[model samples]
Target: MAQAQDMIRLQDVTFAYEYGDPVLEGVSFCIPEGESRVIMGQSGSGKSTILKLLLGLYKPISGEVYIDDEPIGPCSEQHLGDVRKKMGMVFQDGALFDSLTVGENVGFYLIEHENLTIEEVEERVRQVLKVVRLEESLIDKMPEELSGGMQRRVAIARALLATAPKIMLYDEPTTGLDPESATQVLRLMHQLTRERNIATIVVTHQFLDALAIADKFILIDKGVVAFDGSLADLKDSEDKRVTSFLEPFRASLRLMEERRFV
Candidate 1:
């Protein structure tokens, strides 16, 4: 069952790789259960760092981090593990094992977490592959034998294999796909989140991807939040910086739509 309040909360959190250098300064946000949030920023804007903090991979020098209102601490290994069991993450590189086949990769979590038999795992793998629109025969293929888009779908299938109420943390999910593949992945992300009511945080530079699936959006600039609101608020803002960031992409998306009609 889902919790009643925000799934994640960060309050006045600050961090740095070294002394007197700050990467995130007093960053704060609340991600409510079932909300799909997009974290947007240019390179080095600490968007990924926020994900890391939430995952308990990074510790803040000051302030607090919470998952389901339970304070997160780097030292709380057992507690953190329990909390993380409710979440799934997809990395920018897909992060599949080079030696493991697709079926082995998707079945990994089930093997580790559930005492189910091989037959059960195989059945679950097939169901998840169908969710990602991949054929059962492809499960035996090596990761290198698949196309980039196929590899990504395999990764997403693996992420969804867990039956827990999972919150997906996606880092640059569409980085290298072609236009069609990127659009397909974006649509799939939307479909999964809506159908499952899963909480999702997508970290991306692609405004278009965020626009496609986000219930709300937040912008980080130079380690601090620059904007946080709905999509309409972002588009209608008179802020020159926001306009400059959005206008070029808006024009490009319009052109892409026009070309599709011709």
Candidate 2:
């Protein structure tokens, strides 16, 4: 069911590749404002496909994909870019430009698409990097010089700087980070959602840390929403598919039943 305040919506959205079977069928979900929705599933379970649809990179074969009440699925490419300005995407691999400095990567969009000067772009870049807790001095550093967690934070800074997006789409945002770094990233995500009132959609398979911060969880199984609800609802679920997926997350929960978590 869609909500009145949903920043992103997919209503009965169905899609398929050329000459391929359906990747997603009748998928419906919503991410309301100021909420963090984590999407988890096995590889190739249509998780990333949903992100692409939301980005207007691929139009669904049927139904609609709406962002900010705008049906972007059928919008023209010229118009799509305008609609896309309301959202930002963080790829799984921190898709930074290896050749460019952190500042260049973060300011690339505004530099190319907008008429901003170097000083204006740099100001915006500094602001967003600070929001991501990065030093302004690192602006000139290349992506290769940064650690994995630093690179991810840079990627997030780039996303946040892009048009001050109302909705954030993260594809494996915390992958390949050390445990401490991953926890920091998850906590930052939670902070961003609550403090900035951004609608966040995170697609990740490793969701133990995510469980600690996410407001809702959606498990996609075999191209369908196998489960969608709060953590309590998830724990109470009797569905075998849901329970099977929860096994690992539940195990981590039991490890430290004594001390209070930070």
Off by over 4 Å in 1: 1-3, 163-165, 253-262
Per-model C-alpha RMSD = 3.5, 2.1
Worst-scoring 10-residue span by lDDT in model 2? 253-262
Summarize candidate 2's per-residue lDDT along 156-232 as a digit string, tens digits.
88888876889988999888999878877777788888888889999998777667668889999988899889877
Q: Which candidate has the highest lDDT of all?
A: 2
Over the stretch 159-245, how does candidate 1's per-residue lDDT look in tens digits?
888645557889999999887787777777777777776778999987775677788888888888778788778878787767776
Between which residue pairs do clashes occur in model 2?
A: none
Question: What TM-score does prediction 1 earn?
Answer: 0.89
Q: In model 1, what are the clashing residue pairs, if there are any?
A: none
Candidate 2: misplaced stretches above 4 Å? Answer: 255-262
Estimate TM-scores for all models.
Answer: 0.89, 0.94
Residue 36 C-alpha lDDT in model 2: 87
Cα deviation of 70, candidate 1, in Å: 2.0
**CA lDDT of 28 in candidate 2?**
90
